[model samples]
Target: MEVYHLYSGGKDSSLAAWILERMGYDVKLVTISFGLLDNWRHAKETAERLGFEHQVLYLPRDTLKKAAEMCIQDGHPNNAIQFIHERALEAVAKIADRISDGTRRDDRVPFLDLPKTRSLEDRFSVAYIRPLLGLGYKTIRELTEMLFIVKIRESEELQKADYEVELRYLLREKGIDPLGIFPRRHYQSRVLGWKTEETR
Candidate 1:
């Protein structure tokens, strides 16, 4: 009954965890850190607001560095992002019987295709869950608003701890500026707290 959800302090992941908890699972929030940045505290703070047990899991730094290199070579971050996400799932699966993420139906990067999803389940002997997979942007937005207060900001704002920030830092270390490599106007949500006391 314990489900360890990969959390990022963002609306999608937050809603996913909330829904899983409501479904009778003991949802514990988890964030993956590649040891590149110290911003994981933001996620911890958000988890506190959500009233969920939270923990941080560290992934191999070398893989993240490799992913940064991938960004420069590929001229886009889709493959690198997806690579880190899948690796994160595998990392969590090692200590989780049920693993979940906030990826929605419209997410392009950091998405697990059907084959990868099945492979993850079979290889790890763990159930991978995506509570928002069947929900689109509009519905997820409405659901989040009804249950929690969220703030939307550009991805560069870094209100939440996520893999992209780490990749950006790595790219910078390699003398490759991340300003143009990643999209400029990408926006994400940060769950501040519950809009209603009863929901919390």
Candidate 2:
């Protein structure tokens, strides 16, 4: 079946797509853009390198700002991030019957709660899949390193590509410190041009 994969152009999403492809699923990568600020460029580039059909869907600027505002109000990003993620999934569900994301077992924020997960599946008549849900950080990192050549960096430096990055920008614009809301030391990876010959 064709699966619309929520892609971030980061290691985890890339790996999820790769695994789904290997499992013989028809995979199309979809990246959500919140208004003007998004990692669409990087995501498109990575999709080209990985040879996947890719597209960017836009979310309203106000929606993203509201989510950011919630984070600011709550003094934590968990709820806001989860809200944004669900919104993105909702958008994808409209386009495909099979929806998936790069969310792993170790992920905290942006994870759907049981009720929300069931609601999404029931409402959309779609299957929500998380291929990396059973994989730990070390396992994913090792697999990523073995399968592709990547450049790692602190997630903050990855430009306007991630939801957190946009949220941080919104918070800063409102004169709030994002550091006070989010945890320290999140990392993101980019495909540095090629996959290993072994994975070919």
Candidate 3:
């Protein structure tokens, strides 16, 4: 089946797309833009490197603002992040027969709650897949290490990809410190390139 995989150009999303491709699913990569700052450019570059068809979609600025507001009001990002993620999925589901994301076993925010998951499946009549849902960080690390040459960096140090980065920007613009809402020391991985047989 054709699957639209939500991609952030990070290792987890990349690996999820790779796995889906290997499993013989026709996979297309999509990056959602919340505001002016989006990781779509890097996501496009990664899609090109991985040989997949890619597209960019925009989430309404009003929706993003509401999410940011919720984050600030709650003094945490979990609910807001989940709201944005679900909205993105809902948007993608309209255009694709199946939708997937890189949400892993341990992901906190941007994860669909059980009710939301069931609602999407029932209402949309589309499958919502998360290939990495059963895999934890350790297994993901080992898989990436075995499959690709990767560079690791703190999420804050990266080139502003992913929803958290954009959300952080939104928070800052409103004079709310992101660090107060988000945890410290989140890390993201970039796939430098594929590992060759000789290196393996």
Candidate 4:
């Protein structure tokens, strides 16, 4: 069956795609760009390196921001991620009927209610799978290393992202674990800080 992997230009997603291809699946890479990170370049380079076909999907900034806000109001980051994932899936499924992602069981917690539990056809209106859900990050990294895949360095914006820490600080002030909430797009320090750039 044909399969398409979500290509985030991150180590996990890239390695996941590599593993699927090695297992004799006809795979392609699909990336969604928010225009904040140079994710397009990273995904493109990785696809070329792996000799896999790739495609890019772009979403409007305002739409994403509104989604993020709604997610926070709902008191969960998973909701926000699910919303974005569904959007990505919709765009990707249009091209290839089958799809997959790099999310692992550990990355998706019990509280998160990820779509992993559902069969591929249930999660999206197309065939889908997550082969790496049973594997840990370390093992995935090892596999990628063995295949000589270069890790995509975090974008300058992501490298400087303090949103997590900032959120953690805010949570600590409220006496909660910073990691409790699923991180939304606006939760990224770079995206939130864009407004302050005008003052400087």
Candidate with top TM-score is 1
- Using lDDT as the measure, the top candidate is 1
CA lDDT scores, all candidates in order = 0.90, 0.85, 0.85, 0.57
lDDT per residue as tens, model 3, 49-121: 7788999989898888998999889988889888888899999998888999999889887788788899998
Over 4 Å off, model 2: 198-200
Model 1, residue 179: distance off in Å is: 1.5
- Rate residue 200 of model 2 by lDDT: 49
Per-candidate Cα RMSD to the true structure, in Å, reads 1.8, 2.1, 1.7, 10.4
The 10-residue segment with the lowest total lDDT in model 2: 191-200
Q: What clash pairs does model 1 have?
A: none
Task: TM-score each candidate.
Answer: 0.95, 0.91, 0.92, 0.63
Candidate 4's C-alpha lDDT? 0.57
Model 4 earns a TM-score of: 0.63
